[model samples]
Target chain A: MKEVRVFAPATVANVAVGFDILGFAINRPGDEIVARLNPDITGLKIVAITGTGDKILPTEVLENTAGVAAYTLLKHLGKEDLGIELEVHKKMPFGSGLGSSAASAAGAVVAVNELLGAPLSRESLLYFSVLGEEVADGSFHADNVAPSLVGGITLIRSNESLDIHHLPVPQNLQVAVVHPDIEILTRDARAVLSDTISLKKAIRQTGSLASFITALYTNDLPLLGRSLEDHIVEPQRKQLIKGFDDVKKAALECGALGCSISGAGPSVFALCDSGYLAQAAGQGMQEAFALHGVNSQLYVSPINQDGVVIL
Target chain B: MKEVRVFAPATVANVAVGFDILGFAINRPGDEIVARLNPDITGLKIVAITGTGDKILPTEVLENTAGVAAYTLLKHLGKEDLGIELEVHKKMPFGSGLGSSAASAAGAVVAVNELLGAPLSRESLLYFSVLGEEVADGSFHADNVAPSLVGGITLIRSNESLDIHHLPVPQNLQVAVVHPDIEILTRDARAVLSDTISLKKAIRQTGSLASFITALYTNDLPLLGRSLEDHIVEPQRKQLIKGFDDVKKAALECGALGCSISGAGPSVFALCDSGYLAQAAGQGMQEAFALHGVNSQLYVSPINQDGVVIL
Candidate 1:
């Protein structure tokens, strides 16, 4: 194929108890990437970009997330001179904590891999995708990138080793996400966190994470809801997102199994047992945000089983 | 039934990645408690205590773990006036970090419940048993008590709420436990730990724990081994256990899946895929301890399915 277009879904990272370690992909509000072999170009170049309003995204090949991801993958394949032109369509808001950068990077690498006749395995593409993500946040974590690439719920054991595992998702598990119009920069959200936490709180967090994983394997929705607690990060970062507490309360009251800040926030996500409940929770969350005079967009989706797909 | 004699298996708490929240039961070296109706005694009494070798265990009803557990159960049921006599046979060593006190407490509750025609559900007995455990170590953690009472692998989500869940054990999973002939009090071991830990290390620990739980559910033994890491507590407590580093090294060298200090210290445990490998690893751990002029006892067993049994 001379050209390939792929859609990469947005992702929710942290998942309350698994800070910097767990994330899951959602089916909507994703990025689309189109990669084509350009004989006229000597190397990779960003030709066109859309959907990101006036929010200037770098178009330079080396500076852009899509270009950098494609470049990294091509360099890894010893095909750095391969002529490629890319178009990035950002369907999600930037710095929205919905893994916007990860979707673009994942979509780009996936598209480029298909355009190059799939020289590397899907798993082998994660490293380049993560390196591309590092360009946006300056952090080496892959909680966002892995789930967007591998699909479903992803647990990253170690970012240095790129050791990632896909956790089982319950059949009835649905998600409701509310992205408030306010933007909370990941850097600003992260800067509010403490360098150290009490050992008592740390143990409590581990218990929650362990129970949360067990709940997924056993299909125990109530246990999953009870264990979806963030004792360490959420307390510090919630202040960055306006009306996070009220939004979370509204989601839970509307039948969300659990609700918490999605990634660094501004966007809040909830898990529910049914699609109907997810929709209700999303509407409730939106109303709660409105109460705080904050406009928000709501998306209800099932856990995306297939992360990135060809369009 | 007028009388009942029951056995409660010893447990390995923490399990490397889940300090203060996770544990599993083993088949051998457990405490046996015999509870019988006594017309002469007006309340709970510790009639006899054995196997502890000159260690003065509390015989007072409120002070002894077995006595306290039985008393607590009877009190909760409004049967505190009923006459009951108990015989405590301690099969495991004290301060061995093998959940010795937990076994006694669990055995007592199970035996007394059986003697009373099983008035309480098995799940409801965890709280009384945990109260018994608190007499031994001033802390309220239930990692050991829950597993010894309920069997298999247990994850205690919240000790405050008594919210516990049993995790699946792999079919071929085997345990090798080595207890060096030294006493490391839980209090002293806890004292050496810092009140706080770096947030970076806590996140890493959470990754290991989440991965470990996922490995158990999927029966990925290699992944389990890789994720059986203790970054928070082990580093601080290993110095209290003689030959801990060498013994862990020897166990890993002998094809054990994972090895770490069990519970607080003095007792080290290893997980292996086969019974034969477990035995070999146990021997290697003992030999390594011998190099440090430490005498040790080795027990190799499968994951105990029935935590406490009536005889």
Candidate 2:
């Protein structure tokens, strides 16, 4: 119970068709981190947080997701004197719609649980990251966190009870991640959405959401592409992301199953049949963003099946 | 080919939360028909039509869904001289949420296709049935026909290419069907609906639709229950189906996963985990309907994975 390694997988939350209710965990490799039971006198502290720098905020239980997760563990186990430190490999980029913060929180919790003989159930431990999410985004939504903690696709469903489910990830499915060098804070991105949308539009949105999930389980690529439509949020948020339409069109033309803004914005994710097509879609998307004077790194990988794992 | 036996599975269309886009084939047995090839000279001639004569229209190209399907296939194959004699055995009750007509239409087309050596893929053959639905419902919708033909769950994404898919059915699932004697025509059921719904209401509808599909994939029953809500159509339509609220509440009280009007329905569907619970839900629903002076027949069955098949 001295040292442990837990990997948190990246996730796609608010997948185009299902805004808050749908999410999937990519089988692609994600952030890896090591958490150790340090014999320090600090009340939940990080010795040296790797990957992200000064912008990651003060490593205090109040501001840090990993710190919060550790604090929660200590509080639950009635071990206030115990100190823990997390070293995130940051394999998945932070703020890339890949549940970056959730990774930190989930990785911390999983590591601590492993270090302490794993007492809590997987769903029981997921709340720590969800609480941490409330710290940054006023609301505790777990579309990204749940999937990041437990691999495969996860759905937030109702905010109550924090239902976490790990769905099946179809084989050979690849997802292309393109992170544009732009930032649309989750809070800001959320604020732009309309409080009330037309019912016709809503039903159609429901249709698309149903179609998308159906397509995923049935492996209907074309249906998945068509189902990745957001009549409610995308229209309002697309203006926030420069050249979203052109980029999406480019991805589709390049054989991407579908393309949409990942999470709140800036980063875009596209589903493709093969790694080559995914890579092409990613590069094409990056180039389209360049047309709008935006440059970003492209992460071309397969779907992340092994959600959170220890390296 | 002298004899052709084709199968179309029973489908749950207007899937509680998903009005139009979501549908799934039940695990129970469905419709089956045998169409023997007969050489004739003129337009589609249904040499024989039997089973559920009360609901089925005569062999008219514009009225009978079966005739329409046969005609569509004959036109596509460019063999107007091909005579088809379809013998349909209706396993599902007419006017039930289960796609009874769609089953017949899909079965007929598939049987004909087999008799003709199946020149069209399953996806292409679905169009013939979908085209035939226009004869029954006055609109070309594929939600019912798609699942009946493809098996599993289906999503009618678009009419252009007839986007349909068979999604994965959740593990440990069963469905309870309750049909009231009071007749509810599809046209009348649609008549009660408000033509235009608010944008916010629309998004909520989409959320529910997303919720049902998400719940199915993740196997989150509670989430699925939460998502079994309708904002636009159900509210208005419920006024016509007496004891709707009471029956729905009774079914839910009896551990029913979710309950709603099945397709422009007077018939209601309740999903349950066990066959006993399913039967209980149906009986409880009947008792609830009795309070409103409406008598109903309840069918407790599992998800019919096998679509239409030959007898």
Candidate 3:
């Protein structure tokens, strides 16, 4: 078996009101896993597992995200009969909004593709990684995986064609992440959102999304801050998180551009102009959480320019 | 007496499904009238009239659109003590759906401002024109005025703030315009549209708008054509136009990118890729109208790069 290399990064989903549509990668590197082709094995299998959720499960193709990614890739490539051994390094926490499962899954597919000299394009692998997320969330959503796989803030115009896409990363922007010491299931969080939204609300959402894109292009801070508001989702989800308002207020007081629930909640992210402000916002959020009788950690990082990479 | 030069251009409104949100300017120039400040006149008076309905109406300060713009600027600048003489011209017919009122209003404001050495920002002047549109339409709507003043695809973000915005134009675009000799009053058209739209219909409208924006970004010609559809306004408004479907069919068959009612339109605009296609589309639409017993003229012009202008 020859050595394979794979890398994955953390991602932020639901960038403001663009629910299920917008996402981006963060500067901090995520988990990496490597797998090598083992020609002698019989059926599709995960010979080994590491990095994340390893204690909760075994090296099975059905339950494991990385294993599922490899299986799906093999199935798509018509090479399902080939056996492979995967080794993952769990660098980020499982409960964080940093797309832990996606990291593992993307890492697996990337490693396998690299070992085979890269047959699929980056977009194809992104699709493959999203399949792995379905095993964890009971639904396939690319809000997190696409940005982590592609790097920078991505607008998913449509998943089918993957033709209308681009990265709108504003220069000199920083991301401050505050992950509370609590676990909220993504499925449970998603269930609380209303299936119907008012036309007025929807119009506001569309206008803001357009403005956010425009601001990124124009590099206007105040306009970008205005676009970070979500009248549809954030108000309902704020109750799930302890001291969310205080943290948001603190971040705003500390000169953070905007703050909102990351992905499904329990984790919060703030946009800032510099590393100093990001750090301050993160610390403020952590302190606010502490006041609410929960210990939390913060990560002040820049926008991830490079997404997935092989090491 | 000081001479004031005011310029207004034609605007295409309701741009596809961006109903009440999107508009753009046209290269085909409209009326350009000069309002000269008069030392001999008192309490707002007009001195000269040329081109377009000039002799048909009162040159009273409150009645004339160009005169109203001059009054608005004078009022804002606190130079109301000085009397201004307005030279009015009507280059385009009022009911052509090319936003003749907006052109006259914007032209009036620009001419006055330019004569005054540009005391107000360009966007502010745009708002001044929007204000003048209220005298004719009974409400302030930036849909027409912004594009006329801005010279590109302008999206009205907010009228209260007077924050009219511009979007990037797609490349290799052609605009084929057909004017059927039919009059649809703005009031009648506005009355026909349902006050409230179904949620499903609204989403479809938004999707159409989003797809159009994405197509513009991706330079997807076929997709751009597909995205020109509108489920909300077109169905209700098409009943007013003579042989609307036939015109659309002919335009599409003639290699037009797409066709839609142009601003409460008796006129229709078809998008295409080149001059030849635009000309073909124009002729086909005219032929369709002729077959339906309606005489129509065609303008095979590209997307207007210049908004309102002084001719």
Candidate 4:
């Protein structure tokens, strides 16, 4: 195909139980990118930028996540001179802790790969996608990008070497994400975190993370619920997101198996055993946020089994 | 049966990647206890203690781990008045960081259950076993006892509620343990740890642990090898065990997948992918310890699939 359009799903990163190690993709409200290859043209070109959430993104190729991702892949494949034009459409809200930057980066690489005859495997594409995240966020973290590219639940074993694994996703697992209207910059959310944590708290968090992964394989919902705890990062980062406490409490009370801030927040996510619980969780979180004088939007979804897809 | 004898296997706690949350049982050198139910007599009794390693144990029922465990079970069963005589046999070395105490506690419960016509399931028996551990160690930690009781590798989800799960063991997985003739109390190993850890290190440790559990489920040996790292506890506690660095280096050089201190240490263990690697790892560790002027004993074993067995 000479050109292809791809959609990279939004992801819930950090996953509460695992600060920077775990994340999973969701189906709806993602970024869209169109990749076109022109043999006569040279290098990557930003053909256009258009979407509901485009106001917060940079139009410059070097500064944009999608452009940076395409450039990175082109450079890696020794095709930087090969003409490629990417039109990015940001469908998800920006800076809402829903992996907006990751979806763009993932979509760019996927669409470009399809446009270039799909030489790279999804895992191989993850490396370039993480590089795009580096350009957008000023750090190398694959927690969001890996899941967005590979789909389902992903564990970032070693982000430096790009060693990532896709873990088993439990059947009937549903995700409820409530994004508050207020924008919380990732930098500010990160800045509030303490440099060190108590060893006792660290042990608890690690145990929770390990148990959470085990529960996924065993399909133990109650055990999975108990494992979704984050004493290390959540306590410090939750303060950056307004009404987080109330939203989380409301989510749990309304039948969410567990609830916590998604990524750096302004977005909070809850894992539920069924669609019924997921809807209740979403409604509860929205009502709680409204009570705190905050407006919010909720997205209820099943675990996205497929990440980036061509359309 | 009026009398029954049981053998409880030794355990490796923490398992390098999970401090106080993960452990696995191993075959060979274990504790043996014989329980005799005497309807005519009242309360629990210590009949006799025998074995090459019995010198370290206390004869008093209240102070002895086996006796304490038996007594705890009888009290919980509301059969405190029923006469029970426990004869302890210490097969494993004491204070060797091989979960010697946990073996005695586990053996006592198993023998008593058999003597009483098996009134409880293994899972139900775990609570009384943990209570026995509390008496022996002055703390509530099931890392050793749970695995030694349930067999295979076990994750202690919540020690308080006794929520535990046994993970699958790979077919060719082997374990090599080298016990240096040195003792380091669990309390001393724990005291050296810093009150707090750097958030960076905590993240790495948690990622390692999560990856380790995932590797076990997927039977990914290379991934498991990479995950057997302990930046939080090993650095501080390794100093307490002599020749630990040399032993670990020797094991790795001998083709073991990974090596780390076994439990609180003085004993070091290596996980091997095959029997040949296990034998080589054992020899390498023993020789390394000898080079450090410490006498050592070696035990090569499969990942024990059975916890306590009646003979």
Q: TM-scores, in order shown?
A: 0.98, 0.80, 0.87, 0.97
Give each candidate's interface RMSD in Å: 0.5, 3.0, 3.5, 0.9
The residue-by-residue lDDT of candidate 2 on A102-187, one tens digit each, is 77777777877887788887778888877766665667778777777776666554556675445555555688888887777777
lDDT per residue as tens, model 4, B134-154:
776888878999988879999
Of 2 and 4, which scores higher on TM-score?
4
Query: Model 3 segments beyond 4 Å from truth?
Result: A48-65, A87-97, A138-140, B1-7, B46-68, B93-97, B181-246, B264-266, B290-295
Best by lDDT: 1
Query: Model 1 TM-score?
Result: 0.98
Q: Using TM-score as the measure, what is the rank order of every candidate, best first?
A: 1, 4, 3, 2
Total clashing pairs in model 3: 12
Q: Count the backbone clashes (under 3 Å) in each candidate.
A: 0, 33, 12, 0
Candidate 1 positional error at B63, Å: 0.9
Order of all candidates by DockQ, from best down to worst? Answer: 1, 4, 2, 3
Which candidate number would show the highest DockQ if scored against the true structure? 1
The sequence of per-residue lDDT tens digits that candidate 3 reaches over residues B95-146 is 7788888887887888777767788977778767887887877877888888
Model 4: number of backbone collisions: 0
Task: Please state what fraction of the native interface contacts candidate 4 reproduces.
Answer: 0.72
Better of 1 and 3 by lDDT: 1
| Tens-digit per-residue lDDT, A1-311, candidate 3 | 68787678888887765676678888664887877777787656665555455446457786888778877898899878767777767777775666888778877788887877789987789777888877866666677777777788876655444433555667779999888888777766777776666645665665666667667767877778877888778887788888989989988988888999988878899999888888988898888888999787777777786778877
Of 2 and 3, the candidate ahead on lDDT is 3
DockQ of each: 0.92, 0.34, 0.25, 0.77
